[model samples]
Target: MSSTDIEPAESRRPARYHAKREAILAAAALAINEQSAKGLTLADVGRRVGLTTTSVTYYFKKKEDLAAACFSRTLDKLLEILDQALEEPTPQLRVRRYLSLHMARLARIQAGQEAPFAVLSDLRAMEDPLRGQLLAGWRTVFRRTRSLWGSPATRVHADLYGARAHLLLEKTFWLPVWLDRYDAHEFDRLEARMMQLLTHGVAAEGQSWAPELIPLVQIQDDETVNRDAFLRVATRLMNEVGYRGASVERISAELKVTKGSFYHHMDAKDDLITACYDRSFNIMTTAQRLSDTVAGNHWRRLSSVLASILNLQLANGEGLLRTTALTSVPAHEFALMLERSHRIAQSYAGMISDGVAEGSMRPVDPFIASQGLVALQNAAFDMRSWASTMPRERAVALYASSLAFGMFDDRVLEAL
Candidate 1:
């Protein structure tokens, strides 16, 4: 054979190697999204890509390394999108273009034209150097997302922009979970409706930001059990780590109790998580029901419920377990938890619908706005440090303002 022919055949080795490596990454990302970074098994990832565990290890030496690579790729993709968005001349156009591009990317993934990005909810599950690296990448993505709102002129503006950036990024992260519910052809309309809500918010013309604070009532069933401490500690751990990352042993250690004490309060780890969910849902439902009794318009009721829940999230006391843990939930229980979440979102949607009818809220899509509200409150736990810098009420107001008014609105600064 000629030397040129031998050289061409040898050159194909690198291209084939890269192609197989990309395939492994795509499979790993999908598996990580299905289970979680902690729950991911090299064997499982290998099976998804029709390779042996050792073969997968050739591409990624360890499972944590593989998971971190997946997260890094996602962060890289997000930064690219943000860079594209920065090309716009105005913040409004930048935000719109960002959403447009992001929604299109999601649509392409749904259409099987692109590989799925690993969900970053499980970043906390990773250990050591990987965790630090992923966090730094996240900070970069956050900073770029903040830049979508243009440069902040003042400290207060910076805070407002940070909150807005968080809201926007969380909503984008949240889209994949619910996007499957819509048809691919309808993605354009969905994007347009979401953009409208993000632009004008849910408030009607001449509406102000004042919302009554609703008192919370203790759940009756929870009062029957003296496991509040266990549930609270468990919820906190789960919120910090993920579901699988927050093991029974970890919860017991945090509570300074033995495994026996934990078992005494709860039957199993799943049961404990279920109790935490119940407690959170009860708190939310209590706020919603109490808001109904407040003497005001639908917008008032909605804002009060949001503020009350956000306050619960920001307070030093026991806070809501983030929905990010859902990724680690068992398949059988996932449906039930999702159903409960859907009901709460429906309650928010009902309020939005009433607000629109009563001329208190803008004529935006109730379903989209309600889901946006869910994304907002669920992500508030991440901003507790930011909240600590100001009064709890002001933190609640400022954070909730992202969705209450609009991502672009700075009225919350004046409202306080």
Candidate 2:
């Protein structure tokens, strides 16, 4: 009561201060999006808005403070998308539209042609206050989504469909920037196929059964039980700490097993890693099965399959591990893994080809389109590294929609 009374006597400066603070924040975001955040300066923002550095300083004490303000504004925009999507009539359609819109925004940003949207990857490295604000916005979005779709389903979708969408968009937008030769139309086609797979199941009617192919495993094990458990623990450790930094000792401790027990499970860490690779291959096979079982239109079936594949990865929380394997694994080992991953990509292409034949998808070069889609999704894994100051979920969604929509046909896209 006494504190409340004292506050009433204080000047209304806080309200006025916040209004000015928001303006400075908005200006900073604009500057960062126009140029690399790494080289951004408070002076740049002031100049853009025709203010002196001193005037900018009156609102933001430091460059970091201004950066924080920009981050907050970005988060607000992202949350708005989520809110609008959830408010749509059909939850599924809303989800799809949200993805499309989000991707379009990312494509625009990646072109360096527009202001960058807030990326979840970007927010990961922000200071606590900024991070908290971004997280709070995400929570509000999540709560609203939950009200539309039950929490369990929403959470599952967030991990599976949501994460898939995010990764897809991140890659499509960033790769062009990185390589400087990316085609936006090609990316659009790839996104369409991916979305089709996610919406439909993967198995084509009359598809023949083939023996489940087990990729070569370099790990030697005395017993399957020990091999399986050791691989699981090793995968977790490797994903968390990376291959070079991940130690056998830490994995053993987590398993509450002696070094001798760990050795009993595998010949060495390399062996365990190989086993983990084998497991990843096997998991993909299982996903193919689930995709085949779902009954729907070709696009619907493909979507189901895509969702399953993404769900498996999200369940593992091994996005970092996959990224590390691609970029940091020993060159020889990486080459082998890359080959296997390519095969999987080809299989995905085959599914799309089947869809076109079945009149579910528009005719296209499945192999080339699949490669682009794979590239986009793969690039998404690194989005966190680039956008370390933005909200993670928003970054993920933005990337996914971009990749998906970029692949859709002009006619289908117009309807969306």
Candidate 3:
């Protein structure tokens, strides 16, 4: 039926009531793109769909219900991608095609032509059974993606293809944010190029890759007797399962320490997460500073910074700090961490701005470009499985080259 046929406030239910509800959920998805679900009101949703607030409430009693329905529908879309990829005949082709199609989808969003996929906030803010159900759906996609695409033999650990997939997927959710800075076009090229680039290191034939040195930056280690070990263990858990899954009990079990030992180090899990965020960002800051000390042009500086950041995982086995960790921190710490994140971005933009000014890089919006770089480097977390299977230096070089050059031909990178 046409949209015009749907009544704004039908006093009686029609046989197509479920279809109408689905329509409302579609509108909710569009509205959610502009504002988070928590900030979204029933009136706003009604405004987006040309319905009265009462009419909206009639379908989904609360705004949360509407948002929940929207998220559930997104899960349907995600599953569709998985199912489509599974149709491909080869494992590598399946993975490549899946990444390509998904990147193209994100490009559409970057061009302001479509709504974003569900954000992390969307999943976390959702209450109860719906959240659990949605995450189960998400996990199902990862498991299927791994089984259908990942190689059976990986040095990272057998059956840990999921870890590698997570690493690649880490940046996909945030792709639209910075992707607009580049030419918004069919991104299948990016998928194919990146896949090939990753398989074959960016090193020109017979050109030896000199591994850059990145030191382990120390963190605030006074929290406990073995704070360094404790933090390292916590970082592993956070990277593996995530902040939510890394319970104090689980972390303690891994550390072979009792709950009292954990308490001795930190008062609670939230505090531990806060410390992890602090240390992770501090490590990045240290890398940024070290990148500055290198004697080279801005392009060289940016490359060094990218290499150093990737080396956090490549050299040290620590993943990049997640921005979502800020929300889980205390309000005051949240504010602080939020500012710190901005500073890091700003510093990154500064380097890009310098690059543009000096003619080492093409002109682009430094802010957006910096963010895009950060999002890409986030794949360093994939190094969990990747570093094991691939040489760290080679992996870092591939990431730096692909991110710097993207789909564009830049001969300068060849010499850099």
Candidate 4:
């Protein structure tokens, strides 16, 4: 080889470094998605990339560092997508552009052309400065997404637009869980259908937001109150942190009870989480069932179920366990939890299908709309703080109406 053709040591080193670092990040993201931040280990990530744990340390000094990097990469990608979407001339076009770009990216991942982004559900499980940093990045992503609907001129506009922003991002985050059901060739058609729902909404020409309250079947006095207490605390902790982060000791300490007391109510940590899921699903089923008993159009029944659930989520008592916990849930139990979730989604789908048939709703894809509803309700727990500022009824209407109405409809504001 000619001496002039030989690359400098500095150039060769940087190229090699960049390639290895990218590989490590890709592997770490996949591992975190599978097992969550708590389950991530340097050794596991290294094994995926054909490196020793010690060698991996050369790129990221700690597991938390690697996890943070993974989250940062995801935020970076989101900001990039938002930037592309913002270039469009109108809010509707911006939203359509955003979803189209994001769907394309997800399809690429599904087709093995790119690595997956780390799931942001476990962001709370990380320790500070990493946690703080990741959260700030996420807030930026959220603010940029909210901008897709245009700038808000008042507090009410801000809240309304904020709800729309959350709804959009949550559905985007939720795509990976169900997007694989479609063939890669169907992505364009799916995106168009999804955008229709996002822009126009599920309501018919003049469907109103007058949801009758669906009464839940109250728990009997004979039920063990202590077990309910455990579920409440565990559910909140798990929502704040994650499944593994909400350990037995943590739950016991929060309840001011002994570890023995915890075991007395539940068999194990897994059992507690499983029970939490059961409780959430039961509440959902009760609302769905009771809505069926109500006399109205399908939209009335659907809106009642949605409003009632949002009420439960915003109340001071125990709320539903978010689907984000699925990331840290054990594999064996994961499928079971997901099955229950699918059934709840199917209930929503059935209502939507009937509404469409009865001409009470727009001709939206029921499966897609149902999934969007799930994303809306599942993420409402995080909106409790936002919900607190206004009257509970107004909060419910504003937030629930994000999907109950469409992204562009703001008549819900006039009612408030």
Task: Give the higher-lDDT candidate: 1 or 3.
Answer: 1
Q: How do all the candidates rank in terms of TM-score, highest first?
A: 4, 1, 3, 2
Give the alpha carbon lDDT tens digit for every residue of 195-311 in model 4. Answer: 889878888888889988776635435534488788888998898899989999999898788899999998777787889998889989999989978788999899999999898
Local distance difference test, per candidate? Answer: 0.85, 0.52, 0.63, 0.87
How far is 123's C-alpha from truth in model 1 (Å)? Answer: 0.5
Instruction: Assess every candidate by TM-score.
Output: 0.94, 0.45, 0.59, 0.94
Residue-by-residue lDDT tens digits, candidate 1, 136-183: 889988999999888889888898888999999999988987889998
Best-to-worst order by lDDT is 4, 1, 3, 2
Put down candidate 3 lDDT per residue, 1-416, tens digits, no spaces: 11223365653667587666766776787666545565558998788778899998888899877777677666667667878888898766676666777887777767767766545445654667766776676677667766654455533322234444554455456655435546756365555545653333223333232434557465543545376666777876665555655678998887688989889889777778778877778777787788767765667767776777776665554565666444345568766876777688788888878877887665565665666566666546645465565666655665555446532223323443
Kindly give the stretch of ten consecutive residues in candidate 4 with the minimal lDDT sum: 1-10
lDDT, candidate 2, equals 0.52
**Residue-pair clashes per candidate, as listed?**
0, 42, 0, 0
Colliding residue pairs in candidate 1: none
Candidate 2 Cα outliers beyond 4 Å, as residue runs: 1-27, 30-39, 47-52, 100-114, 142-198, 201-416
